[model samples]
Target: MAEARAELQKKETELTNAILKDVSDIVDAIGYEGGYAVILRSEVVLSAKKELDITGAVIRRLNESKGKPKEAPKVKPKEKPKDKK
Candidate 1:
């Protein structure tokens, strides 16, 4: 049971890290074009001027970049457990 739990936790952590890395990459891609030094999510800030907003630009960039060919991360196939007769 402990081994199974540890394996599950490891898988969860890997999935979480992959998701975060993807988010970071997307933000970097948007920032590369927007020239923004700081980008905050909507829920994080209390109040900000419209001129300081980069959300619209990022959204537009995302839409424009959609359906483009992207490099995929290579994945190794998992080994299957042998069944006992």
Candidate 2:
């Protein structure tokens, strides 16, 4: 049971990291395209101009791109270490 729980936790963490990465990628692209100097999270900011907020734009972009294909990261196989006799 513990092993299963650990596996589930691991999977959850992977999913979270992947999701965050995708969102971060989108945010970075938006920032670059919009010529934004910086983008702040709502949780961290006490106040900001409404025009500076890009949360809605990000959400809209995500939604619009849903069902579209994304390129998978290419991973190289790890090579075995050479053994010294």
- Candidate 1 stretches with Cα past 4 Å from truth are 49-85
lDDT of 1 by residue, 1-85 (tens): 9999999999999999976676677788777777878788879999999887776766565556555658899999999999999
Worst 10 residues of 1 by lDDT: 58-67
Clashes of 2: 0
What do the candidate models score in CA lDDT, each in turn? Answer: 0.78, 0.90
Overall local distance difference test of candidate 1: 0.78
Top of the candidates by lDDT: 2
Residue-level lDDT tens digits of model 2 in 1-85:
9999999999999999987887898899999999989888899999888989898988878777676678999999999999999
TM-score of each: 0.53, 0.72
Best TM-score among the predictions, by candidate number: 2
